[model samples]
Target: MASIANKVYLFDRDKNLQWTSSIDNLEDVAISADGNKIIAVASNKVYSLLVDAPEEKFHFPVGYPDAEWYEHESPNGQGWMTYNPEPPCYGYHLGDDWNAKPPPDYDDYGDPVYAVASGMVVYAKTVPGDVWWGNVIMIRHDNINGTGVITSMYAHLRDINVSEGNVVGSGQVIGTIGKGYDDKLPSHLHFEIRYGDSETVGIGCIDSELVSGEQGPQGQIDPTWFINTY
Candidate 1:
């Protein structure tokens, strides 16, 4: 089976067109009885049809950073990450790390942090501890042409300009970079995207798995993947 232009087409293994269904906006689906019936998902509504096996929708074009920002602190090869635990904190780290540290430039403190895409601000607050993300912002994007729901988070912020339930536009300045109470750390933005509600630590949030060793938010997607480049 395949989908095109909001329609689902069923094909036999022999490449023959078995049937077709006119779907308005397919969000998800499930099938049963050895491809005899299918449950088509269209947001709040679900439909049941005969003759089909379950199929998952592909997320195409993915999502690029719709926000306007200065620059990436760490590039591809010159980055650090914890996603891969070989050495732990492997790669370049989850955040694109725009305007990052090492030089401790005080002027960088108020550097503006922009929303990578248009969405509702779901969270913003301060978390305790210099290790955990101190100041943070989380935004939940509504359905994008049935592309599935996702969330974006900005951490280690110094200032938050948006509140919960606030709809923010792509490239809008939601806050400034801050290091929270970590006096030893320079102000830099730690950002990431999650598959769902994910998780947050009231004052802010943290991926326990990334820190300790328990299962954490479904996982963290590299923020660089969403960044738009000219």
Candidate 2:
């Protein structure tokens, strides 16, 4: 099957058009392993069609389901988004910078960072002398809503509570916020959601065309939007 513009086309082994479905704003399409279903991503939502239906699937990184948190523009207390993923001179940010809501400074230092969803911890360690990423943890989530594998990264952590191969549950405590190895930036958590490769610890930023608003280049997406959507 192939998706073009606002439609999805189904073809047989001879490459002849079998059928087509009109799905507005279609972005991607995939056939299930048994060829009994079709999964389509459109307008930031997942559609599961019965090869005949369609359907859909954030817990949050710092708090539980009922925890009150804000992003970049919080008017309430101790947490807000400090920086959004955007293309800067250094390259695309590739993640969101979340800090305590108020009193600023290092007040949020040592605060616990939770896993946004259940997944296997792929990387959990500090890169010696790397000031940008103090202690970091990466979790690989597989077959999410039939969207395939995606990796969540937490950086500038003060403490790492999980190992490289441990399977963590959603909202599990994994680390604490920190001020990077060099103590240059204030206390905050640099969170990222990477698509495709789950093992590589990317440079955190890259030079490429921006997509879907402030979303970084390929391999990275808007973390806040992703959490709110999925």
Residue-pair clashes per candidate: 19, 10
Which lDDT tens digits does candidate 1 get at residues 1-230? 67677677777889899888887766544433234444455543445544343332212111123333334533344332323223223322444455533453434676777765555667877765546577788876544325356677777788889886565555567888776556334555666666566446432224332443222344455445433311
Best candidate per lDDT, number? 2
Clashes of 1: 19
Q: List the residue pairs that clash in candidate 2.
A: 48-53, 48-54, 48-55, 49-53, 50-53, 58-230, 72-81, 78-100, 78-101, 79-101
Model 1 residue 56 lDDT score = 25
Candidate 2 stretches with Cα past 4 Å from truth are: 1-57, 73-89, 103-106, 213-218
Query: lDDT of each structure?
Result: 0.53, 0.66
Question: Candidate 2's error at 32, in angstroms?
Answer: 27
Model 1 segments beyond 4 Å from truth? 1-92, 100-106, 128-131, 199-216, 228-230
lDDT agreement of model 2 with the native:
0.66
In the order shown, the candidates' Cα RMSDs to the true structure are 12.8, 12.9
lDDT of 2 by residue, 1-230 (tens): 77778988888889999888898876655554335456565564555544332332345676454235534442123333333333332555567777655544437788888877655677999866666777889987666656587788898888999887665656678899888776666677888887764666667667664655554443677777777778
